[model samples]
Target: MRRDDPIPLVVDLDGTLLRSDLLLESALAYTRAQPLRLLAPLAWLAGGKAHLKQRLAQAAEIDVTTLPYDQRVLDLIGRERAAGRRIVLATASHQLYAERIAAHLQLFDEVLATENGVNLSAERKRDRLLQQYGQRGYDYAGNSNDDLPVWAAARHAYVVSAGGRLQRRAAALGNVAAVMAPVAPLQQLRTMLRAMRVHQWVKNVLIFLPLLAAHAANQPTRVLAGVLAFICFSLCASSVYLLNDLLDLPDDRRHKSKRKRPFAAGQLSLGIGMALAPLLLLAAFGLALWLLPWRFSAVLLAYYAITLGYSLYLKRLMALDAITLAALYTLRLIAGAAAFAVPLTFWLLAFSMFIFLSLALVKRYAELREARRRGETAQASGRGYFPGDLEMISSLGAASGYLSVLVLALYTQDRATVALYSRPQLIWLACPLLLFWVTRTWMLTHRGQMHDDPVVFALKDRASLLVGLLFALIFWGAS
Candidate 1:
């Protein structure tokens, strides 16, 4: 080829052509599909990263259509292709996934990727391109420091989604053709907050339930303990939530709203998320052990254990998953009672179990309902329910909800109710209001208007908020 001929454009797949890492993507997919065999991926890694990538690619294929591609990179590739410049897809990702992406985009004239025993990344990638294109015969597009070597060998470097430091480094190579705009710090902060799910910390407020139920508002020490418990629980819960998101990447990518989640949307790096999860958990446990009672710390450990189990295996069990979710919610209440040394009565436990169970089923029912609307006939992703199970789920959920109301009614008739309230009869009014709210919740879920998480829905719903205020008012008046 003549030196005057336009240099070939070679694009890196992970973090370059695509906004996400395919190796991490495949690993997450494999784990989600076969969580019980998690060691399988690790075992492959023991051989080499190339073996790990190849094994995961063969074990669980990612949906190329759902991958978050950098639109700017695609546009650049398109413009280059239209100019009759050859475009190549080169990467450290396994050949299996790379081929699928190349075929999906249909823009790459050639594909160079890791195969056999070789992990074609960094220097390996540079060597391969050098051998194929000769020195300065190709332009490369990449992101991250890993691409620094490849950029040095290329005639012109193109950076994608890179920060200022990376741009400066590439410029020192003295051949940067273009630099795509980076994500803003504020936007990145928002994405990180979303990934950590700070909003969901509201659920940790359940640690205060015993404080309210015991009418211990006048006791500062108990109240302070509850606040600390809430913070500890929030930190631990966020840790679990991040791990769940990491493991559920493939399923989340296929989900309607979940696809926008940080990990699934490529807004957060998998490595950073993986590191952050355990650090957060450690911080939580450190706080719990240092500040809370021993029993509270033990209860927090149980919560973590159960949540890990649910994320690992229990979530796949039919009917059992919802029951376990209810149990988890009940555990929060129990933990609260433990935190403040409050008595956890049978009435409170009974009411919590039934109500949380109902909400759990509501979550499942909503997922199945969405699957039906999406024309899916198979079981919902990472769930045991099929769309056809909607009717039964609704029936069972409504029954559990009503059972909670029955528990509340029975509690009002108890001698303890008389001891705690000036007019125990007024406590009976809460039963009907709860009935209305629970029934309305199920109705909205049935009509496909509810969020996937019922708790989140309740937090945002105006009607639910009003009912909560009224319930608080009634209880305070009785006290």
Candidate 2:
């Protein structure tokens, strides 16, 4: 009963009242204030939008309270409420942040943010608003061009100062109105990069594991197909990651370290993810279809569906969680075989599963270990594995590595073996090195020193690095 129009006042936080420009300002201030080691990465991220929204969300949560909110704007909210209107604070910022801002204003009856845990970005904000207010008629106020879609989506549009390019283009639209916020290009760029999360693309390299061991060494066509497969897979994976992050933004903001993720941090917006996700998917499958045809296109589609399920339902399950993750990795190998039209052997299938299962278990152990060490409440996402249980997982990981070695050795000697290893004699050298690598890696993992990702760790750890080199050299020299 605070807003004058009882028509339901839909007010956006970032641009309409709290100067939206403050986000970029905060980002710049943060970069300059921090040590170069930290600031440099953020600034570099700014050059691209890979992690922009996340960084901004984080900055907002950390510094929004400290920054001086406009007294006039605060007074307007207070006075507007006193006028007996149905006031509401609408924003694409994290719900936590939005709620805090709403509470501080105390003029609104209800606050509409992203999912209570999900960071509300532009599109999400629009979606929620529409779900409540309807698409044909509702007054919408926002700061950036990203807000235009949502505004144009409304019955009437109120543009804040930060809406430069968007306002110019949308001014002619019947419902558009105008307001003020500062605008800076470089600062926005920095925020955008942090939101995109480019570093995560490295995970896509897993798609190449099958090629590393298979017989594609001499064939350029197969090699090219493999690369294309990984690239498409990476794009799809990242798209799903973005969707997952968008969906989990709320919980992530609650978590200690995960809060630093782009969406949770406020640098990215839900609208951006919604807008970008389809484009990314199209590109992923477009390449999948162009390079590999229907068979592979189906695998890529399946990967997407499986991962989307993981994001929504499977990830929270305990043991099943790791199994799904391991299967997903195995699928990458399967996809590679299909892409190259190469024959897959029993050893390759079994080896990939066993290795990934152990690796997934190790990831669970690391997560649980972190939780236990911190004395925090942690639940296994759906993997049937617990954060506090590492001993069994460690043993299992060790067994998996050794078993992989055993399988590969037997595969070399198996009557059905098509490889030229000659009675498992040459392949035997790979055994101890694998044992050394797996054991050492697990030893470090148990000690709580191994990085969260085993694949990434293999790239960095000196011993595993050496093991990988030895495996490649031995395999090639024998050939």
Candidate 3:
């Protein structure tokens, strides 16, 4: 074949023209849409990969426009198309998704993808290309070891990889035309850590609430148990974060700020998240079972189950979502009490529920306000909330927060307060500070200045920190 001949440029879809795998994307989407039918994918896969892809494609609705496409690959294809080279989109993904992506890009002259019964990949892809273009009649761009066969048959190969390992292997075929640079591994690692949401572990500090409330911080063994409980809960929380991110991939991609998240942006692989979630959960349970009391383990297990439920279903229910979030936060305190074998007072539980419920509502309010800012008049995606419900939410959330303060005020006057604190009246001062913080939080949320997570916001907010310090001093003085 002459070098000047009109050789077509064929691009692989997953990890080539796009930064994500369609199979994994569709599978996750399917899981999110029909969580109850999660085991159905395994059954479909029993038939074959193509069959699995086909079933997922039919069940899951993927928005191709929002998918993470490789800009470099798009630019390359654009250049080739302008130069009158035929551009083909060849992917192992389902034909449904392949066609949709091709239609969205509008740069492919034809699409060759998995259809009917055959998965158009590896040897089959190579054979198909050979049958269409003869030897050395086309150029190819691909990623992954699965594309090695296609690369060997192409007149020119374009490698898309984060590192040179794949480039070195592709170059061995003696046809490498170019290499597309990918994000550095270190940067990708940081993004993956962000996906794990290590910062949100601050919420696990609630596990110390029981210790603090019981005035047992001076007890060395109790402190150690609290620390261990925090670690176990943090691990379990991170595990839930991973699974939630996986399930919320589609919804996250639609959100303005969340779109940049590692999983949503395709910076991290779904398979990694899937594998790490269960492993982290196991580690959390193992540590709890070995070191903590059986009651603590039970509480941790309950936390995981409820959180999993919230991620899968409860989160889509309007008021119930906030209630579930509050319950999760309260469970952290319960876990702490269980860890230390401390008696959980009714006052503490009531205060925790009301306060955390308010915070949960703040989270939802912020999301709705953000959606309104984007000029969306429809219901919040993947949530059972509409922008119009903002006022009612604010009303209910503020009232709930104030009720917590009322609980605090009443607790200060209780007979138990006299038994616990020498200067019980000093505890009364905390109620106004609690009220002030709650009011300010709602104000910021109403103004769309609050983070999605109120606990995380409190960790970073100067006002919230100052309030926390004052509240702690008041309690210490009372004790």
Candidate 4:
């Protein structure tokens, strides 16, 4: 065990050299490509994990370049290579992915991975290494308890972990050489909350629109129902957001800002996302069924169903994506009406559809602009949009927004308006306000200043908030 010993430095792949798992990555990629075959993984798993990995490796096309590699591991390999030591990559990941990753890094002199129905993990990995290098003949670098057997057999152990617990355990083996700690937990609770997209819960405010339109806000029971419905809808939406992030991992990794997201950046494990999504969905439905009316529960179910569809398929279909987004927004209003036991007015529905549709288009337009800025000439990744379609989207969005304003203007002259307002003419002021806000929104989108979500942007924009306040005041004066 001299300093110049020629013992090979063997490194583990998943959780050692990389911060993420290839098995989960390949499975998600396969699922995203063929969403209809989601059950295929279960059937494949019946053959065992090795068989599953082989099948997924053949089915999914993973971009190895975009993977989250551990820089500490890379630096270790670099220093070892400079010292004239042989470097080997030994992983339990499928051979296809392991080889691809090895080739991408171009540092490994040899690779040993799961192949031929033999999963190279734990005891199997130890046996394979003993066969190739003999007992206590090589230095091993690994993470997780699964590597304990291999570490026991190696001459020295290099523990790669975020915390000291694993390092302490590895030290018990009495051959611990070095510990390479990656960026530790940055408050995992905060990361999980971010993955849940709690900020986007502001969209659930739409659930109170029905109570406001029906002038039932003064009714304590109806107001309470609205609050409950908001909670249920927000939970459901957060579930969908998690699922969407899981599915959009590859695309998000290529985006500038999206790459920093918890899942895409490998700050959170995909297993956690997979488990939490359904739990949140169940909680949403449980709350709706137990506390809210059955009608509200039904609306919530429909909302979840539509969102699932959008996440799986509709979001990639050209105009349908925007239309579905608008429908989702309008469903919030319907949920509010159901919670308050109030009928949705035709005027309100029409106005919401047009306005939300315009906002949805703004979202798409902003994405396309971002792609153009990134110099991507092809279709927007994970979307059915081209940068060339920006002009058409702008036109359609502006027209839809103006149409909403027109709907508002016509509503002011309706018999319903005369009954609801003491001075109906004051409602006319809202039209110009709506028109101004919509025009400014599109203008910002065209100038590439719009956030990826127009609704979220509106919540933060100063002019948008001012317009909203003035618009609310006009409605109050009219009443």
Candidate whose TM-score is highest: 3
What tens-digit string does per-residue lDDT give for candidate 2 at 1-479? 32346456577777466643334433533433342344554564654442454455555334444333545456655655677756678765555566666676567778876542444656877787788878754666666667767777786676665546666766766776545444366765565555555555676665565566564667887778878887888778778777776655445655556777655555454456667777888999998988775777888888889987777667777667778888888888778777877677788889888888888877777877877787765564323555557777778777877887787777767755445543346667888887777787788888989654787777767777788788878777665
Please give each candidate's TM-score: 0.95, 0.66, 0.97, 0.96
Q: CA lDDT of 470 in candidate 2?
A: 84
lDDT accuracy of residue 366 in candidate 4: 86
- Report the poorest 10 consecutive residues by lDDT, candidate 2: 28-37
Candidate 2 vs candidate 4: which has greater TM-score? Answer: 4
For 198-224, candidate 1 gives per-residue lDDT tens digits of: 999998888888878888878999989
Top candidate on lDDT is 4
| Root-mean-square deviation per candidate | 2.1, 12.8, 1.6, 1.6
Give the TM-score ranking, best first. Answer: 3, 4, 1, 2
Residue 148 deviation, candidate 1, in Å?
A: 1.4
Q: Identify the runs in model 2 with alpha carbons over 4 angstroms from their true place.
A: 1-11, 14-163, 166-214, 377-386, 416-419, 422-424
- Rank list by lDDT: 4, 3, 1, 2
lDDT of 4 by residue, 1-479 (tens): 34487799999999889888999999889988998898999999999999999999999999999998888889999998988889999999999999999899999999999999999999999999999999998999999889999999999999986467777788999999998865556677789999999999999999999888887789998888888888999999999999999988888999888999999988887898999999999999999999998999999889989988998889999999999999999999999999999989999999999999999999889889888887788998888999989999999999999999999999989998799889999999998889899999998888889865888888898899999999899989877
- Candidate 1: misplaced stretches above 4 Å? 1-6, 40-43
Candidate 2, residue 337: the lDDT equals 71
